[model samples]
Target: MKFKIPDRRRLLIAASLLLSSAAHADDAARAQAAVTDLGTQLRSALMARVKAEGPVAAINFCHDQAPTIAADVAQKHGLRIGRTGLRTRSPGNAPADWQRVVLADFETQAQAGSAPQTLRYSSSEGLPEGIALRYMQGIATEAPCLACHGQTLAEPVALAIKAHYPEDAATGFREGQLRGAFWVEVSSGN
Candidate 1:
């Protein structure tokens, strides 16, 4: 099929739109991979600590190494990635303004019968510096996560959490519920 453009400007615009769409799709794929890699590394490290030392040691590892792990993954993926929620264990993990909106929407979607793991959001934002591709994937509370984030935590776990995060509010979660989200932002020149 032959397609005709009325003007060069219109043809350029069409090409730009197609290229932008392709770039967004690529960004989404990379963002998802980064989230998956970060989650896998974190879970593996936490499990190893729990097996070798204990739950408390796992908590300590999260406090000490989670940020480092996230940083490494972000660097490897050429984007910024982290976990966030309304109720955060660490202050550093608190959702930013835009993320708060997305998290709230994810919660609403979950309440409306969407599975937690099926909730995701992505958008492109124009920033002063450049355009940013933002993405979020919901994290479900699993049975294994109950060791630290369940309604009733063991004394040791509670103590360890308090020692690490005095303002913790990331508990009281049930299995299959929305725990939080993994967020990724890819910007121009990143």
Candidate 2:
């Protein structure tokens, strides 16, 4: 089918929109990578510790080393990064308002058969308290994850968790269910 050539103004506006969209997409990809990389490093560390030491050591790593890893990654990436869950073990893992919305959407999507690794999130604004580019991906519970985040824990595991996190609520998750999300953010002006 033959089509009329677009007018100059219309063509300019279309180009602008396309470019904006592409830029946002690029930013989203970068954000996803940062969060994924950080999570990967932390998970590997925890898994190695679990295999070598045990659940108690893994729990301690989650309580200690994990935060250090997150902070280091955030510093390296120059972004705000963290993990949050609906039922959090550490108070630091509490979801912000925007994170709550994203987590709820993740739950709904997961219930409808969306795999956690396939979940994607990106927004240039709408952060809970500030303007930022936000990305979050759900974390599904896996076999290794169960050593610390399982539905039922061994007595020693429970004691270790209690000793570390007195108000832990980040358990009772079944394998393949959403354990939480890894999120990354940067100021919109960045």
Candidate 3:
């Protein structure tokens, strides 16, 4: 048996493809880490705030500090991470066009009997800087979230939410329902 020797150009192309695949995998892993860290930290901090002060105070924390915490976690993971939904409490948290499509898909999956927490989406897209890895993990509404996001909010909680987000639409969630998602975008050069 004789084996043909590959040309140098073919070998180079194969090597480049291999490297690109490896980079894509690395980006996905990093984005996953960022999502987990950001979600855990945000939930813990919001719970602590609600316990110490009340749900109203938790609203303030979400309004003022959640973005900062997300930024820190994204930096720690060398990516960009945040929260978004079909209905956002903060206008700034509204989903982008791609994210809206993902969120709607998540909701459809959930309605079709898939658990909300099991829903996730990821993709790669071209950007001016290069390729970007985008990931989103579903956030299921829990008992604690009811205080602020449930169908009926306490008067103070409602007022607090209104004060912070005049156009809030993130309420009306029930336990086990889809709340939103933690989204991450990983790009070249962090």
Candidate 4:
């Protein structure tokens, strides 16, 4: 005896699968957009701070100001934002996945001698297996970025860093080194 599946049942299964995938994709896109917008605002504020103050001051300002900026934006948008940095060596000498990604992108741009810029990424590995995760660009170096993140750290820069973060291990950066990256999280209400 042979058995056959009903055509209506097959169609229903196919439609459900398609709908699920489409929903997942939409959520991911929304998360990406939210993080991208946050990155834009953060960069703008950082640039303005740098222009007003020197590199060391800019770094300090960012350290002081970024949290508030992120919090305000996240609260308004109903999202979460986290920041991390790239350094010559990872904290506790452990490998940092986020740093690795930023470094790779920074190296590619450096090899081509282009100005460093923001990079973005998305993932859906965790969180209900369908929710999208997003991160925004965090370039390692720029012309002005050198004072705080350069081949050789300036005296003032070193002092400032020590003052702010005594246990900070973020140093020994080259012109195009990946010094840090930002991670922003968003929830797609889908």
Models 1 onward score TM values of 0.93, 0.88, 0.89, 0.68
C-alpha RMSD of each candidate structure in angstroms: 3.2, 3.6, 3.0, 4.7
Clashing residue pairs in candidate 3, if any? none
| Candidate 3, RMSD to the unseen true structure | 3.0
What lDDT would candidate 1 get against the real structure?
0.92
Q: Write the per-residue lDDT of candidate 4 for residues 1-190, one digit (tens) a residue.
A: 8797799999999998897678667655665565666677877887887788776877678667766787877776666665565443223323346546655765566567654454455554454443355544545555666666566777887888778766666666666655555555555553
- The lDDT per prediction is 0.92, 0.85, 0.86, 0.62
Model 1: residues with Cα > 4 Å off, grouped in runs: 1-5
Question: Residue 17 of model 1: what lDDT?
Answer: 94
Candidate achieving the largest TM-score: 1
Best by the lDDT measure: 1
Clashes of 3: 0
lDDT, candidate 1, 20-44, per-residue tens: 8988898899999999999899989
State, as a TM-score between 0 and 1, how close model 3 is to the true structure. 0.89
Clashes of 4: 4
lDDT of 2 at 126: 42
Pairs clashing within candidate 1:
none
Q: What's the residue-level lDDT of 108 in candidate 1?
A: 95
- Name every residue pair that clashes in candidate 4: 85-180, 86-179, 86-180, 119-137
